[model samples]
Target: MADRLTGQPFTTRSEIIAQHGMAATSQPLATQVAIDILKQGGNAIDAAIAANALLGLVEPTGSGIGGDLFAIIWDAQSQQLFGLNGSGRSPISLPLNYFSQQKLTAIPAFGPLSVSTPGTVDAWYEMHQKFGSLSMATLFQPTIDYAEQGFPMTETISIEMALSAKHLQGFPNFAQTYMPNGMTPTKGTLFKNPHLANTLKHIAKYGRNGFYKGDIAKTISRYMKDNGGFLNEEDLSQHKSEWVTPISTHYRGFDVWELPPNGQGIAVLQILNMLEQHDISRMGFGSEALIHTVIETIKLVYEDRAKFYCDPDFNHIPIKTLLSKDYAQKRNALIHYKANLQVGSGMSGSHHIGQNLSALNHGDTVYLTTADKQGNMVSLIQSNYRGMGSGMTPTNLGFVLQNRGQLFSLHPQDHNVYQPNKRPFNTIIPAFVTQNDKPWLSFGVMGGPVQPQMQVQILMNLIDFKMNLQEAGDAPRFLHAGTSQPTGKKMTQGGYISLESGFSASVMQGLIDRGHDIQDLSGEFGGYQAIAWNDKKQVYFGASESRKDGQASGY
Candidate 1:
């Protein structure tokens, strides 16, 4: 039995009936939305769509209708995983020549130019048309109600909004919508977004067309034209989310799955492949040796991402070659047992030798996971690129546009150079692990570029060190910013790693001795949500990060 806060058996592990289907997310309202959908006899897709819609309302900064979405859906009946790529492409009118003519180095911060095709609504409709068993009206009611009626402000939402308040100052619509009185809403305050409510009502009535081709589109395009943005009606009308196959790799006795190029899923697979070379279980959980190995692997994968990963439509990602076991083995062999080398120093024969990785700080992304009684599962992640995204809110739209275009390189000759209709490099990566063709876990971490690193470490903690879902997510983490040539050949700033509250002082000291710059973090790093199926007991156990105000609930 699990003990309660007061030492009473508030709920027994045995008394808890394992409803084969469950839902968990970074916001309680979103979780409730999924649960409500399930109770209304909706399938996994319906519940997931419902939850996702509500998340945009409850956690506006983390995600919104204006952002991109990615998902890996497991069809329990078909025994296959399907990938949904809802990321938007650049505007057709945004030509390469335009940048040259304007002498623009990079995409602007906000207004209309920063907006992509806005495929999120279209993607949600696509998923529903193919897999959902509920009416679009039913799926959207929860979100509409939350927006119209009101919801209590959560501390996590409050703190993040407050931190990014400066960015919000520039956009009048954003200020009026989120910080109505020009003040951050305190926790427990009842916040309502009538504009968003009207928007949701429009979506529910006209399907995705409501947003893509009707009044909403006209309103948005008009706002962009009036405010120096580049988006137009054609960009919105031509957008369509693609359904692609997910990439997978076997680890130990399980098959790990993630989405393809344009996402950092391959990086997650690469990190796992590298760690598979050693008997990480023997290192013990939270041990310095294990932590060191994980950190080093993260550095390698992130280096690859910074140098190579981009939209598959634009660049050949070489995912198959990179994730192959043979390649991982070759890369893993370079790690020296006793010393930590500077980032990019361990690459054996890679050509891009001298390039330095940037120390860019990112904010705002949302993650959610779901499973149905029929065994259907989905691990979904979405983001607006930055908080209040680009800080450009269209008048009366009740949402901020994403600044994803900032991810593109400014150099005209670079492969990731800014171009019209090109999707920028993205950091949102959602993952799943299965044993014998059955999903054992569906999980994700919400952060900017740090997502892949966090996912890899959590997987290691669970599969390698045999920790529970909570423990794995609760473990201390380290991030390698890679080498920067700001000063000289001195490996930029090597360590600057983040250690969670639970790590021992000795472990921290060991990392310091290993030439790592360490920093102590207090619950400000990231949020993880997971659903692990206990095969033996035939029950599903869900855990949400305690660092955030989230909940894991099951029916």
Candidate 2:
């Protein structure tokens, strides 16, 4: 039996990681590396970057050099929250005319055509340049070592790799990199990628130039040409991570912040605002009424998401109109608890906007949270879009290019229609919560649309149900997915609700009686990681998901 550390009856899966610093990530080694960085006097930014880089190497099924990134960092000194939109843009060379010419109604989810210019390396360097204490080379050393010498394959990674093989085996270099022995490695097998190590080493030595330019860029260019993909060196060289202000909505006095679109963080705010309209606490956790309210809110907000959320650089999104309390008040009236759920975007004199239930991709991202002694906290999420990405592996890169372009709509009138150099609609988001202008929590969940769904439930658990960070994370969750699927499928009426175990039979029956489409989902809720600060005590608490091979630790 383990000796309990805290005297206050150390309860729940969350640990009191306080005093100095703490780090929680989807990989145990990455978590340790982050804590080690904190101990070495690196700040939260450096610790987060260190862990995230390792995730790219170890959890390549989820994230990698070929994917995109998003982060919300709480600057303890400035008392200001910052957001980074690290998502990549579509190929400048790929025009809307091409899709129209091909008569394709949807962006292909796999193959070279789906590839976007990867932005993760730029994100790592940008944050580090702004806030890191450790040198770039030093921050990436742990991942480099793991990649070259190999780290033991986790059961989750092995499962994902095997699942991906059938879909990705024929893609170039994928077999050479991930299936070197003509098969996915079994759990605990020592998996090494010297090629990935070399790629990482190049960037560490040369900084951003190493990735966005030079040999790395050329290799990606060649791969694109050979595969008929349109992303070119210009797209790679022109890429820059944007520093944006975080958007927030007050929920029960706590301010929940998310990055502005093209990522779906705003959806997190919208759902929260709708829930705040009613006394969620009065309904209680897992109650049919609460579940129904949550589901109906999601259905409405996601209808708005599909209609208007897009790359702001290309489309003028009415952020002020979308986040307004008046808008939420109007939307909240549509939630008839007793009626069958048939939802759509409410008319806003607002952006005149108009909205699937396809398979929601899961388990393709690594979410991490880190805090430093200085009070800086980071909530970061990185992903390859879907497990193993587009199956378009550049030779010797040891990572698959992201298929983010798949989120684009083929409809010309759609705000999210694919265009040259535009970012597609993004799902990966990192979140922060502040109370009384002080950093309260930094957290995120992994899984496509499930990211926002999990965010709402996690915040509600903490705020409404008074659950600790660990308990909030460990609690069974429900996913109401009626949003347009990335596969271009139509959103279903009364979108199916996937409930995890623990709800009472009566609650399930109650939902059914209310005309809810109920189903059981085994493990697709999300993998959560979060860090909460006890401002009075000057300490932090960290929690890692029970569903993932992850850890939360501090010194």
Candidate 3:
């Protein structure tokens, strides 16, 4: 297959092309903000930070300062990629004994117990210190202005706000900040948060200290203490983003890189490794054979994910062994024409694979990609777990604390079991593709487990099927939900598969005939945004998800 000259039925629009720079984000305003930063003499890193700050203000339903951040950057100067793990840890003061003492089987989805130390602000500062061209104040000014002056809520965000308001209104400051006048903002409503502006101003002037060591930290600690939470000033102050070496797997001569454990990114690499065994292109896109192989591969990889993916500091992960081609081949051999509902971890031994599980769906998140004239590109993702997060808004903070800690398993023997000061198993990850040691693409799909599944599909679409950047993102995707997660959930029913509306009835029937359970679940497929570098053309290509209020623009 080759790149199509005519439009494919799935493509929403042609790829945005430009020589100087390009950006793709979930929100149009954020994309414009990135472009503006690039035009203002800022590098890709600076532009990404600026756009993320603005997103925190305008798209708080998904991302905010209260969430965690992860990024993969293609540094033009070094000609190498960098990975940043900006995820936060559970409070050291919160002991596992407390949960056991309370007789709680699982952490509550919302409220104080789920909140963790926020790491987004520190991650921004760290990325800036290493690669930023503009001052922190300059990068933050646009968001601060928008926060105080107000910005129009997008259609999707407004509906999400109303939903969040219903669940989080009881939390301190949530109603005041998001539900002004006792109601959530509707589409086109000009929402303003002067308090968030003040907070951003503090960060602009004092850097990470503004949030981790100063008034913001103190306020968060006080609120948690009074509200039956365990996070404190110490947890905030001790937080630091780690600069990690990105790991990769070669697929069809392309090096696909993702961060190590504590995030589910490697699941993409695992799926791809297993997929490399089959000539999927021959099976054809959306064919029953292709879908079945991918789905079965996912189930096998997720079993390993549930058992091994965790905070590296707490347990040693066999990163090398797990990503081995031999292991992938062994796993791939298990796939057949039919679905396999009864799967177990490939490696022996047992931790409590979760007895009860909640399908992580519609995880509110933001993913954006940017490339500048200097040839630098950034793939960044940020999120407040679930919807608007833990619903434990600190008084006057104007943001919700992330419920990421809810991902930690209560099972004592699990590697991802709840532990004080340990980072939870993260769902958000940034991805990159390099061809022959040069940056080729910076992209990400935003949702929980939907991420790795989409990542593999995107890669296959581009490499195996030869789709253009936009077409790859816009193509019909299959979401494999209910797989065992790091939360120790077991897959007793083999889980189910959800396909986008674009799939043909023949494909659906084929999958069902193969013993695969197919469901019509829309809006849970995850949002995608990507930027691909065309070295020969000396230009960039960008694509944004049509399912979202997204934009892919260049200049």
Steric clash pairs (candidate 3): 354-488
Candidate 2 residue spans exceeding 4 A from truth: 1-14, 348-357, 485-488
Query: TM-scores across all candidates?
Result: 0.91, 0.95, 0.98
Tens-place lDDT per residue, model 2, 1-555, is: 232342112234546576799999998999999999999889999999999999988888889989999999888778898899999999988888898788876777789888888999999998998888889888889988998888898888788889888899998888999986789888899988998889988998888989999999999999989988988889999999999999999999899999999988999998887888898899988899999988888888887887778899888888887899899999999889674456666764232222353655453788999999889999999998878899998988778999888888776667787788999888899999999998998999888877888899999988998877888887778887655543345566777788887677899999888888887667677798999999788788989877889999987
| Stretches > 4 Å off in candidate 1 | 1-17, 96-113, 338-359, 482-495, 520-524
**Higher-lDDT candidate of 1 and 3:** 3
In model 2, the Cα lDDT at residue 49 comes to 95
* Predicted model with the maximum lDDT: 3
**Residue 409 lDDT (model 3):** 89
Superior by lDDT: candidate 1 or candidate 2: 2
* Counted clashes in each candidate structure: 5, 2, 1
lDDT of 3 at 221: 95
